[model samples]
Target: MPRLIAPGSLRRIGTFFSDSGYTREALRDTLELSELPWRKLRNLHFLLHKTQEATALHQLARIFYLGQPADEALLRQCIPGAIFGLMQDAEMLEVKGGVAKPACMVAPLENLVLVSDQITNMEVELLPDLVLLPNPTTLTVSRFMLRKRGANVFDLGTGCGPLALLLAGSAKHVLGTDINPRAIEFARFNAALNGIENVDFEVGDALAPAEGRQFDLIVANPPFFVSAERQFVFCDSPLELDGFSRMLAREAPKYLLEGGFFQMMCEWVEVKGQRWQDRLDEWFTGNGCDVFVIKGFEFGAAKYAHERLFEANPLHPERDIEIFEQRLAYYRERNVTAVHGGLMAMRRKAGSNWVRIEDIPHPPKECFGDDVVARFAGQDLAAWATDEQLLDWKPALTSRVRLRQELTARDGGWQPTMQRIDLVEGLASSLALEPPVASVVCRLDGSRSVREQAAALAAEAGADAGVAQAEVLRLVRRLGSGGFLELPATG
Candidate 1:
């Protein structure tokens, strides 16, 4: 097994960089120990401190270890900043498995450092059952929400403080709260080690300290794991299956400012007789917030148990089939077919709270929740109105767009379409279109009345105007919700 570096050792390395010559000597020794091929080592040493160069080193080391040699000049071209300065700062160079990987170690600038193997061992000894690592998705989401909300931010379950640290970059005041004292200590130590002063970590449950305080953006990566047996401190929520979700739904609303957004990534067990959406919808009760639930990935109960259990005891992979079988049976007995994990974005509304549960069977490859965040921040649905807007406002069109309906088949056939259209003057327009034709859809033009556009379309079609009038009205309403057309201004 490869030796993992302890956090203490990493701190020592960070401290050692106070001496310039000592930093260079340490890099030289690390390069020697890695036994990297000469060309690779040369390029790494040249780019050791440069951010871009450090990135290249990581790439080159992977390639070199695979026995493939890359051009040193090309590698050097990727280095950022003066190579000499970076080389002198030992804190910037991280050695793992004997190969030097470029990393940012400036405490005040970028506080988080990758826990190399040496540090991983130290963390394991300190926290034992609790694993601490960066969760990129949570970090990305929290950073985005912080920027969008532009006020105070709260990170529940700070873990290693990745999300809190990222939030601190943008939020006015960032507070990270954790239930575990060890995690709180680690978070504070990490902040101090990285020279980040804006973030504050305190030992407290999710909504406890946040009771009186309200925030514009709240982010949490709570332990939403649903397990029959709990072993690890970080992975298992004290609340059983869906308990975290229940708690969040009940508590988060109290801390959110009016129209503030609460974004979280969680796991929920899919129970029989309940649609996942319905189960999630119930959690949004009483909070005057619009909820958007996106189901990202689903794993069978057996796979969920195995994956989580393996996380705790990865060293013992030789467990027998019988043991695995019993675990699968346990999941079956609980009626848990699968565990669904995904992003949940909720906005507290000033008026009635309506929850929209979208199965989101297929979310975009990238985070679409960011789009929701943008929409919430902009608060102007009109700005997002493009093709869909013109069509919805036009009262003359017959086909209306219904977002709830599936219009086209996967193989390219139009499914049964149903829509309700509204006229420019606040009257509901009913029209249906026959298959095999596409019609012009637009919003009501205040400059022209629906009657006039209908007359023009009738003349263009060269038919009795009444025949196509109803069809046009139907199309207009269908496109209305889709923002295809605009309604005429009312006095």
Candidate 2:
């Protein structure tokens, strides 16, 4: 069981960490911690080699991040007496033999600091209900999900509740749910530690706690790993391979308000004799939400097992061989060919729905929340609007759009050989355009309607107006779907 900290003590601890410069900026800039690898043992040596003096920030990093014990007298000299007492009383520090070690880890995430149970070391025994801090997937989902303000928001499988706390800043009310009681305790403790009061954490299975309640936005970082056993509460699920993610896709839509959004960080298996997209899209066949699956990477069965089995202790490959073989056998029995990982986003609507599966190839570098909203609106326009309706609508390119050309030396001056337009934001998509398509795009200034532009281009080329209009509509739909062009408002 985790010890609960009083609200007052939590506030004091937060103040102490902030005032001591235990921040992302100081860690990255002053300590140069970003230059080192993330392993625990390596980080300790790196810090020792980088700085000789043990400042308050150094002491905090050693205890919390590097997983090293610090002298009790040294900690007393740096931390405030009252706050130190609060930390000891709350069981955040384990002191013995004149040395103190952190019972939990506190690290800066973006602008906020979060606390979670100490990360699992590969050589150490794994705990069943270990709470995890923000990882790469958490950061990816946080950057990709929609961040629009709403009256209510829901976070499923909230773990230590970082996502729920982030949503609280923009939402009127936020609720986070998890199945592990230990995780819920940590979530509640973190909520108090961060001084965020608008969020609530509950212990419940899957989406049970938020059932029958409509939300403006729903985000989940659930235990969607396709593993053989329920080894870890933070990553593994009780359901068989990939069933948990499929279950969430089918059930979560019922809890969303009309026009609400649901985004989840997930992984799905690509079985033999089946298209992965077709298999996953079947989950939302008649469901009332337009779905988008942004693929990250795919791994074969053997590589997938090795990656996941060695996740905790990558340094000891010899120890993981037995476990890896067992997991690989499990996959072989199920005909699993490959495993895919990515983000799945859905928007609730009341008509025929469309599902788009796009491969991103690389992870996103920055937040694309606004780009997601734009793509949703753009797809809606493309799917429902007729050719005539599209011509009447005025669409304009976003300011982030830039055109690039490749020039080669010809007989005289440089001549353009290849041309492409790039959308610098969101997914950073770059598409090659033909000369005719390039000419069509340049005319989109939002001042002239599509019909007028199509007629003018037809007159310039002596082509049939109807044929030109058809070509223009195709270009608009393609660009709009990619979030390159902004379309007029739809009713």
Candidate 3:
């Protein structure tokens, strides 16, 4: 294969893209290409009519973003001759019979233009080592990542290296490792294309490249699909039945320095007669880490097979039933009742560790790095502090917290029947609150200590002061674990 990337040439192509107004904002506004629900964005039917204009932006979108061929004359008219020559030398542009097209797909991801293999239409035709385009999961993992400056980060299974490249902006250094050599090539090319020097790519499975090295943060979007076959390196693990996820959970802590975090987007199977939490607990037990889990969604065996089949071959509806049956049979053999997908983060720490799980309706839309750090801190405090010790600590509601009440029409007036507290930003958690719980939450302003607040609440409710203090401690622990309140650390 010809070298499709050169340092200087990639820089020129980036300049060309910028000069042509090929940007994320323009793609979203003009072409309707967006970040979420990437299914609609991948189909070219909607863009066919929208890209009819002959502007440079539209032409670039057609040839690169939409994977359409452009006339050689039109390409010349749109791209600068110098840029065109550089692309040709780099083997990025393919010209045949006076029609020009991108040999690889180039699409805007946030502030970066990522290049990867053309999205394949056939599952059978997909090579085992194909480098994949940035999908919704990539965005999810990126949003879930903690952005601590000057940290040494690792991007495991870093296909195409988008996560590593994104972290390079703030990280002191980043090392990305992948099992696929083709993926490593694309990752290195992308790093050069973006002119990012702080990140490096290595070809290795799991953590082999980082042996004997410790990192401040490690993030992965590994091949966690619970598939029976290893057809795609980007999604299918060679290990059977979600063992890859288990392996990561079991071994990731070995590479993390004290207080460092390991975060990943993964899918795990829920076996018959076994709780998923217990299964995951087995993965992290005695690993010396405080774990946090977010279960975004779950699918029964049949539904999971159907979704996987459709994603593997969206164009071939006729083959769906056959492939679906095969996958279903595989799941039956493994006793997988359901498959759950979500994000998992583990912080390496000593002493009695805690595992907290949050069931979210969907993945968070914005970055919640600080919220994640705070939640870990809160969990640490809750796990170690005694009730009496917690009394001296001041707990405060998060800045964007809101209390909403459900009112019912009774006796010709509205009556509050239920109340819920919502964290408008960060984790975006909402939980039901009792009258007493609401009252306690409303008063936590970091002004008065928990002991004082408990006494006042006890006096008002005519309840035992000890019982009131216990309830307040329970509420504080729950809210703190969910990122709804800030608990200052104590000695």
Count of steric clashes across candidates, in order: 57, 0, 0
Q: Report the lDDT tens digits of candidate 2 across residue range 71-137.
A: 8998888777898888888788888999998888777766567788776443465677778877777
Model 1: lowest-lDDT 10 consecutive positions: 114-123
Question: What TM-score does prediction 2 earn?
Answer: 0.93
Tens digit of lDDT per residue, candidate 1, span 51-80? 222344333333222123334445444443
Task: Between candidates 1 and 3, name the one with more favorable TM-score.
Answer: 3
Quantify all predictions' global Cα lDDT against the true fold: 0.53, 0.80, 0.82
- Give the TM-score of each candidate: 0.60, 0.93, 0.94
Flag the better candidate by TM-score, 1 or 2.
Answer: 2
Q: Which candidate number maximizes TM-score?
A: 3
Cα lDDT tens digits, model 3, 197-221, are 8998999988889899999999999
Clash pairs, model 3 backbone: none
Q: Which ranges of candidate 1 are over 4 A from the true structure? A: 1-129, 136-146, 306-309, 320-323, 359-370, 374-491
Cα error of candidate 2 at position 466, Å = 1.9
